[model samples]
Target: MRVHHLAALVLACCTPAAWALESFVVKDIRVEGIQRTEAGTVFSYLPVKVGDTLDDETAAAAIKALYATGFFKDVRLEADNGVLLVVVEERPAIAQITIVGAKEFEKDKLKEGLKQAGLAESRIFDRSLLEKAEQELKQQYLSRGKYGVKITTTTTPLDRNRVGINFNVDEGRTAKIRRINIVGNENFKEKELLDVMVLRTPGLLTWFTKEDQYSKQKLAADLESLRSFYLNRGYLEFNIESTQVSITADMQDIYITINIVEGNQYTVSDIKLAGDLLLPEEELRKLVKLAPGDVFAREKLTESVKLITDRLGDDGYAFANVNASPHLDPEKREVAFTFFIDPGRRVYVRRINITGNARTRDEVIRREMRQFEGGWYSTSKINQSKLRIDRLNYFTAVNVETPAVPDATDQIDVHVEVKEKATGAVMFGAGYSNMEGLILSGSVAQDNIFGTGKFVNLMVNTGRVNKTYSLSYTDPYFTSDGITGGFDIYKRVLNTSALSSVSTFNTDTTGGGVRLGIPLNENDSIMAGLGLENTKLDLGPNSPQRNIDFVNEFGRSTINIPATLSWRRDGRDSAIWTTSGTTQRVFLEAGLPGGDLTYYKVDYQLKWYFPLTSLFTLMLNGELGYGDGYNGKSLPFFKNFFAGGNTSVRGYNISSLGPRDANNRTLGGNKRVVGSIEILFPMPGMKNDRSVRLSAFLDGGTVFGPGGTRPELEGFRYSTGIAVTWISPMGPLKVSVAQPINNNPGDNLQRFQFQFGQQF
Candidate 1:
């Protein structure tokens, strides 16, 4: 009788009758209406036991637990003679997900994004999750300046209680920035302030550069740039008050407004240092670039701090900290600064770890590291080591991090990560040049062979003007002391009949040479080699008198034992695009004993890149060449120096700047002088792209000394021109346009010249 009353009291778990029910023992719990979910799975989620007393609270708890699992859409309880019956209606599982009209991103990518939001295929479908996924998708489009995008989702019920979801998307056009206004600018013009920002109104290059696209990240960066511009120019109290961004109704145009407060400019009243005197106070004071009455520029202060810390780092204080404290006088518009230095404990390298070099041996990278294990940890050494590894060119990237060892304050581990690139090439290609005609070429070269730091190359080329076959090998670590050794063998044939501008001659040369490199220091090296070459000359009737004289004296064919020595100091920051370093090279080639002709030639060249501003670079170059014969032998006419081309004296013809023979033909001179001054900048719309460079140059060169020094060296042909260099997908491309200055009547002036080569 009591069981019947309990069963009757609970019509359903959520009913009011169940709330008034009395406690009763549970006999058996059965779960029904679960198709895809297992009966055992339903039992695991039941919170009540068979022997426990069941009441309104336990029944409600059971329903809440089942619903929380997200596997059921509806859950209820039924009572029958003290037996508990739990019924669940399972949610439909997603069988498949499809996307349509997704052109901005791949369909798989969109599905992946939905998966992150818990709305993937073969998962229990939830309307809330679907809503969240749609919002996330919209955010992605918005980030790309797409203010007008539409997404519609559909649900299709499939067999076996599964459903399919389809999302239709329409990616609209990108919004462009139409107006940018800077308010409250007192000292600088609005245009002047806008010029420093990355975001701008539409311009001629906006289509390619995409700067007209409004982006939140770019706007933030522009604000920071504005802050830096003011802070670096003595406006210590500059502040950006607010910014407003708006889009048009059609979502095609955007407007940005920035409000700023440019406070009083401050000058340095006095400067002082308050820190540990690890170095002499006078030296540290000298490192401070600011003086009394100097404008208070934040950049100057920051630079001073960095210099102090770097100086400390050189002495093994790898974690040195330098900070500045400023004192402001509002009335006088003056500020004073005090630099505080803290020299951290001297640390030594505990171990050097290498990673990410799957093919290259660790020793190849280790050999380039200047910082060794179990040595004093010098920051400069660590930086230099990374630079050296990057300069290897075998790896695409090299990175280093000094992580402190656990429980070891005085020791740190240097972790070097490198990304290896393809260092070998098998090439078969054809190229054409205006001067050299069609050329067929093939090469098998490896800069890093078999996980070893060695180089080997075999090359063959056939062209109208030249043919070459060569093989070479080099082991950079030939000796334990960083000495390098290499050997080369080559046969070259040259035919200059097509080169009407250059002096006419032809030769078939065969030679083999062995060389060694001795490292003078980290940035300097000396290369010495001895070669044996045999040359067979072919001179036509139109050849210069000097070529005739050479064939007559050397009997049409001659053997030469040439000794070559070259000293190079390369301190440039980059070999490809240098900006602020000096490079100097001196080379000497002399005929040694056991040679048919005894002669010597020397060339010296210097290049300096001085950064005049952040965007402008001043480059100065000088080259001098002198060659003559010894032991009563005239200099080899074929060995003479030739100038005047894209490389030197841009307005003149190729190898056309020099003395003339008795027949009034262009004969190359034994002496040459070339100097150039240039201002280089990035190409338009390609800021900081190292592969392309543009420059305005002043070039001057003269070749002389075929007859006498005074008469031959009298005139130095000069030209002012604009040139561009691009490390294009093919090869190095150079174009120049020049106008000659102080023209001579018979000069060969070429106003424009361009050279491009293809490699495969």
Candidate 2:
């Protein structure tokens, strides 16, 4: 087609402009070349219209404006005999926009967020959109405290007349809190003030939790907390004057300085109450645990306020606010305190709302919530529910919010959001101890079983001298009253050749039991259970003749009904990384009269975890077991206690530390006590995931009979060893090489003993 003909044809199809008539002045002006655009949109751009003169400059300006809309590519103005024409070529509509180099964010989310800045996928490409995207990217980084980030945008025109956009971002080094300096502090030292602040030095753990990274938002919060700290303590005029943050010359470190003006410290001069109370004023005053002539303490005052409000709440005043205001006397540096209370209308919780639980069932959260619909609002119960959810270990984060419903003045709805985490795990572990060589154990378990707060576990133990199989289930909350229940089934075979035995015997055991757990209090519980067992004995070739006579006198193939009562108290900081606490368990088991075994066993175990510092932890474990038989007999030798091995004192052979015979084989005893001390610290140059650890341990113990006629004190043995543990993908693998520190006569000192998947 000819160029002019094609142009004329395009003009004919689009809006037609007014033609110049001979001797006719242009009375009106309009735009032609308008496609996919409203005629009014074109008219709105024209500087001249009806009854106004139409010149070439005016026509050009109108055409330019129309093209600037990013809707056109060609613009021209034609004037014939003072009649002007505005002609333009419309741009093609964007068919698609493809984005690349978006790894930090999802493509769809970035696309949607870009649309808010006039960069929709189907819209025509423009340089302005790229500029806007760069700004948005920088803003996103700034929100996350990444001030050193760099963002670049590249635009490419595609074959289909569409544009491809790429946003290349360089998230530079994180700005960490290098130093926090507090100035103008008289009462407290710099170290003390720094301890009060949450921002801390970047230590070995900084990379894991990222808490040492500096953020203006967090610093602002810390400053506010500091202000409250002084103000609550009767420093009413205390104020933070300025906070300055400066970056180092290398832009790698950040230094923060906070300047504060601490006002006069005051003592309590008088106390008064200004509130309507259902009880006498004296009673209300007593609830506030503050008195005249006492030094000003913000924490105590805050607690006192809460106490008054809680007291009112218990009397059906659910919406009560208590504020303690201190009036300072600057001359005497004394303050007079007044308690102000406001009791709003009593209201009940109409309903509780739950949200953000994308996968978990609603009942899972609801079951843990102590608050109920139609019940009086209890802040304590709500807080307790939050704690319970946190303890579930099924969620990384849980939050509960109460937003008042619109048009419902006295009613509020609660919203709970939970982010789920992986709680089910399968672990296969093996370890070598001086006691049990090449021990293998594993567990396949679910912590949150069937979306309920319960546990189910299956375990297996395969060791040189011990083999065990067990299945267990526990319901943490068997009833609404916080009681728990558990059941276990196990079968084990144990060999005692390494043990210092009074007799040469091995035992094969199969048992199953059920337990009922009752909660005596929040931190204390009691458990009682009955187990049925069948025990078989195999006398070794070198069995003591007298011991064999005692066993034959006692009989084999015994049926035992062992019932035990146990108590445990745990106060460790972390179960795996404890710095300080004690765990003690005591139990007593007595076989029933109907069973073939007629004996009573008492056992006690005590464990202490002491955290010396951020890098060191010490653990001590001790155990004592004593058993006696009644009715003219003794406890079976197969069921006796033995010590020494990886779990026991490390340097000696398995069960080799106790009393031994001339042949170096273990002779079972009626009483035993074992004690071990282990020092655990981070493996040098390793992370805190505790994937690997190095430890040194000392173990000492002995086994003796009721008459104490077996081994002499000079023959008592002990062992010491170094251990290495790896928390690998399969499970925990441990290897220890121990040597006997003290050896008895005929004792075979184990030069090296190793194990995997065990802890001692």
Candidate 3:
């Protein structure tokens, strides 16, 4: 067979003037010069079929239609005695793709990205698609401040009508910000304005924070911060005129210039409310936490608008809108704000749909919903329901959406979506603590047993000084009203002879307990428990007098029915990663008359977290404990409270803070106090990761017994330290480095302490 160039055939087929042509009736159509393309595919794209009339107009149309399919580089037509022939040169397919010198992203990830952009292996190759892939690779590097990156693309022809594509990337040094200039600012100093920005020049901390790197997103956010800073300080008309960011010729350094207009400071002269006040006018006025003749602050204005809108939402007006129109007087530099309220239709929840729960039952999630079907849509209740569901910790994520029902103005449907996570674990573990030399432990736990929102755990632990065995179960919804019930049985053995701080003695205790949790409100709860335990004490020859006296007073073997009551209020945004909120707990435990002893211990603790900035938080914690015996008996020596430990006072030895005996060992105290202040932030390079955190803390604590010669406040010690907490694969880990600020003579010291699971 002889193949002729299609260019000449197309030229002769379309032009009737170049060659003589006569219209003929086609008998059949045949495809030629196709290696990879099928003969049927050519016929499908052809406009004319077998037995159709063939002329200059029909032949030109057929030739043009074949080229439009993009399956061939050229197309032509030939007529052989009332038969038409179609020839097509198919485009080559991509056989393989290779990416090299890509250190920032995985090769497979880069290839996947190219696949989405329409250039990948086994796909027909096009020059335009190849160019697009190159730009995408460059754009990804540009996002990481790599301005000096170079990308080269190569295409090689291979056998079997296929081609190979390669992308070679050169990722150069990342650009850094050398200086930042603020122009046209009069009211605020340059240093103050720079302090508020996330982008900055090279500094001591910039190496870890990477704030010195140039990023378009960071610059835009910094400009917005400047506008907000001025507006909140009475600069009502502040504006960012322009921002100019320039890079060095070598693309290694960046300079940013921001020009801002600081308008005159304005004061509020009057305020008014207008338009459709569904609630009482006086009632809405009280919601405004601003006053007349105050500085015109945008922050305050935004708050007032939100208050009114949220109040309306609570009243079932889910689509309410509150707009503030400001009246300005240039001469007096005063502005008056008028709030316009528009309460849309009062909507009701028509249906509640739950989805995305594979292992969990629908009833388990529905029970946590405060918003129900056929109920008026309340924003507060919906928000509370989300929080309650999150607190269950049975799912990785939970989301709710309220979409308006079609053809209904006063009805909507609530859609709840949840992503479930594994809630069961079986672990074999070993840990080491500074006080306990070596510890071995094992546990099996299930937080959502059978998707019914029940909890069960079995644990066994052994150490040089302490050993424990326990089994526990809990039903979060023991009743329909959200009451919690649980029970546990345990046996524990403790020996202080190996410890240097406390008196040398040993105790073996066995017990079982039942507990109940009653919710007083959304943030307040009361917990009560009762249990019976038997303890047998063994005294060593080196025991302190207090321990010996306790054994003589109340026999070596004693039994007690312990009763506990507690109240707690937790308002944190997250129980696991608490960044803001206040928590208070008051706990009391008593040994009742049914057993051999009668004593009571009460503990009070308060913890507060205040956000200092977007990236930092200040936390304060304080605890006080007191214990005493009833019926004129002394507090049990085994039950005394001692303060110093890694969990209490970091720089001091475990249980070392109290009055000492003749052997210079802690005899234990009846009263104790512990307080600490900490600055908390995410660890470097892990700002968005919540599983790890760092803190700088100052701790102070001491214990005092009735026999103490010194005043209650005299024996207090103080320390300062840095601590880190990380959730590792084995278990939770904590490490601290501390320096004792003030320590009395003979007080034990342990400067570095850490606890983490390890295998022996």
Candidate 4:
């Protein structure tokens, strides 16, 4: 009898007994067992309301409707004294989420993932959704080669019908690739195929590059590269059969295998151009890269199509399409290609929209864009505008989008977006040198002050041998015509008493200058400046005759007005780590007739870079300077040139490589020459990084005194070294290790040199 009553209650929850309940009309509806949910919510979901007959189908429909709301765990219905009672047990809401022992991923990132999977705070909890979230968390670790990662979720019930979900994670060690095998390669060797893949077995550089770890994304890219290799090698029907990745029981080792099929080789038998050829057939035919009797190269075929399309775009056809169709002869092992050209209607830009420049003024960026509003669309010009904005160095990134205007087939909008970067810096640095002992410096500068496109800087340097202070300001576009203007004020103090090979002397100089730069063309500019300086020379007891003579003849101090003119042309792809470009400058400085000393100096510098390969660049640099006195006045010793340092030669002490006095003290020279050749490459373990650079260089340079004081030919020095430059978080750092190839006796050698916090 008890079992029969329990079965009747179960049946009553799912459906009512219509024969017994149809006679009873529901007088009122009441809800029970709901802690957070309102009674009206239950009443709204009930199909049979007050004053309506309660039947089996109506009761079943009401239960189904409440369950579909996803807010309840259980629902029950009962009839008592002609009244209906609806009861619901609400699911607990998530009050808090905590992740413990997470290192590889950030806590916020994990929480965000959980939120996307419907397990966030204040959301009704579901056990099935929690299981999916856990599986997803494990998969993320698996993608990073952490096969042994373990995750456990526990819910702690709280007051107000809420629970806290805690995810305890144990991220195990990354699995290392133990072996990689390439199968079914007939023409190519296994080693050849593996060489092109980024993933490799554990090696010397594996820790930094992480190339020994298995990644699905990296594997996909590697497969595509493999396919391209065979297709470019005349295997026209190459395909990847399968790839398998397996891990060991302990999750410490991984093995990958790739199976591929390389079909028969094919050669090009003929190539033709079909369809609408808006230009002359001869003109378009010349752009094709493939020829008869050549191996079928997929890369060349793709390039030919792009070239044809670009040519059409140059002539105001922005929507041109060029397709290549190949006709294959299986038995003959030959292929014929026909390129179909479709030159669509010429489109114009309806508008050019600039956005994302919250700090920089609109005019500051608009002046760099080459694409104009309401102009004929040119792909090259639009692309050039993007590159120009990128080169400004004020923005971290620049992006462009072309969206066709709705209901206007002949017009499109060019949307440009830019992300600004911090252009101001404050730096303090210290370094140790064998000769100078220790040096300290500091600077504060802003390249784009308040987004006005102006520059300002203040610098101070205090060293054992050299001390300087300077302030400068520049207006890049000073006038409406794009002229550049700037002013500088400086004070310098140089003491040579601590040098082993230089005369013991001290000099103080104070000067100020104003300059204007005029642009002649995109790559060329002319700069002119005028300055007045007062220099005081103090000669020690053991000072050289050259210094003593200049001080005795010109008095303790002298004033001079100097005028300078310079022409420069720069075409480098990047100011730092340039790979291809030519830069040249010619500078001339002369003292005016009113000055106590009348002298003139000429300088020339040229630098060129050639990209020898995709990964290697060859660079050449040369500099020459010559100075002489005019109107029977001698060139001031304070203005003489000195060499043998970071900016001149790398293997000798600063300014310690010139003519020597009776005390073996170096005397400044009037002429200087320098040249260097270097091969630049990426640093190890950072194949595509641009912020750091490494190079092997050979440098040769010398300085010569005036008249009969010039040294012998052996005085010229040569050095070979390796150099590294890194744009670290603090600032730019440069380090070089060099050995003098032709070190004569008495030549001061400095084998290693380095500096940090260098200005840009």
Candidate 1 total steric clashes: 0
How do the residues 1-760 of candidate 1 rate in per-residue lDDT, one tens digit apiece? 3233324434545476544656789998887898889999888888998988987777667767888999988776777777887777899999999888888788888889999999987799998999999999999888878889999989999999999988898888889899999999999999999999989888898888779988889999999999999998899999999999999999989999999999999999998888785999999998898889898777888888888887887787888888888899999999998888888798899999999999899999999899989998887888889877877877656779999999988889999998776677665444333444444445778889898979998878676667888999999989988999999999998776755555567899999999999999889999999999999999966786667777877887899999999999988776545678999999999998689979999999999999997778999999999999899898888788888877788877767677764433456778899999999999866886877899999999988855422244236899998999886666556788888897676666677777654533
For every candidate in turn, the CA RMSD to the true structure comes to 5.6, 9.1, 3.9, 4.9
Clashes of 4: 0
Ten consecutive residues with minimal summed lDDT in candidate 3?
1-10
**TM-score of each candidate?**
0.82, 0.66, 0.89, 0.83
Model 4, span 283-374: residue lDDT tens: 99899999999999999999999889888876667789899999999999999999998888888888889898888888888877778887
Query: Which pairs of residues collide in model 1?
Result: none
Q: Model 4 compared with the native: what TM-score?
A: 0.83
Choose the strongest candidate by lDDT. 3
Each prediction's whole-model lDDT (CA): 0.83, 0.69, 0.84, 0.83
Evaluated at residue 358, the lDDT of candidate 3 is: 89
Model 3 per-residue lDDT tens digits across residues 547-650: 77788888899998999999999888765567899999999999998788899999999999999987799999999999999987777888888887678998
**Candidates 2 and 3, the one with greater lDDT:** 3
Error of 1 at 52 (Å): 14
